[model samples]
Target: MKPFSGTSLTDHALTTGEVLLTYWKVKAEYQWDAGLAMSTYLNGLKQGKLLGIHCPQCRRTLIPPRVFCELCFRPLDQWVELANIGKINTYSVSYVNWDATRRQTPEVPAVIEIDGASPGMGILHLMGEVGDTLEAITRRLKVGTPVQAVWKPDSEREGAITDIRYFRPIG
Candidate 1:
């Protein structure tokens, strides 16, 4: 791989000087169907709740609801309502946006293991209510820090994971 020059796009010139490249403005839309297990899980989010599938054999309650247990090699049994509160298992802070653009405020993303789910079984979500400075937020977002889901109003929900905007520190 070629070593990066660490220069901005506008600073780098094309190999052939005076050659103008035409850029295309494109727009597209895409869709994906999350069958059975995921569908039910998203529905629960729409209703301002959390749902998990229980594996009778291992008794593991899985979040984001799995249809089968990879460990037990059997179908997951009934759906169980899980506690909205949980603890931060792990996390990361991003200074850039999803498209790679830099932002003034960093985004703190964390994997919170739901209260009633099996150990280390958690969902990746943004950490909210943490103040702007990286140091301050990082200090507060320690592993095992208690948190709770902050749900969007039902009227604003679209049956997606975004239904719960982010998890905030539990008072």
Candidate 2:
């Protein structure tokens, strides 16, 4: 006895018929391999030493070591130890989280070119101990600032990048 009091098919095609819906909640676990060069690199980190791969063909030493030379397409076989000290290549002072959340304490991330690696070869790391105030930090920490890795204690290291807590000013 009751009829639907709604728009017709021509007016609203979707409103007249049933629509099938599906929800996929996948919980897939993945295990990634760091491969040969990175494996050795992580091993070195556990010991508080910085390791890099040497590309003989192009004569470049790469930091955050790689399995092959990106420039020459040659295998990187030689592992060279790098100085924990490096210079700030470039940096930024962030006031918000990556998710756009405002952070109570700003973070200073810098790209540091580790010593013994080719120019412009660097790793992204956080900056610390550059003074408390923005004026002091900006004055002291800038491009070309000499900084050293503040490594966490060996017992606390988990073969992760955080093994180096942050890069602190050398002087």
Name the 10 consecutive residues with the lowest summed lDDT in model 1: 7-16
TM-score of each: 0.84, 0.82
Per-residue lDDT of 79-117 in model 2, one digit per residue for the tens? 899999999999878888878998766788999999999
Model 2 lDDT-worst window of ten = 7-16
Count of clashes in candidate 2: 0
lDDT of 2: 0.87
- lDDT of each prediction vs. the true structure? 0.89, 0.87
TM-score quality measure for candidate 2: 0.82
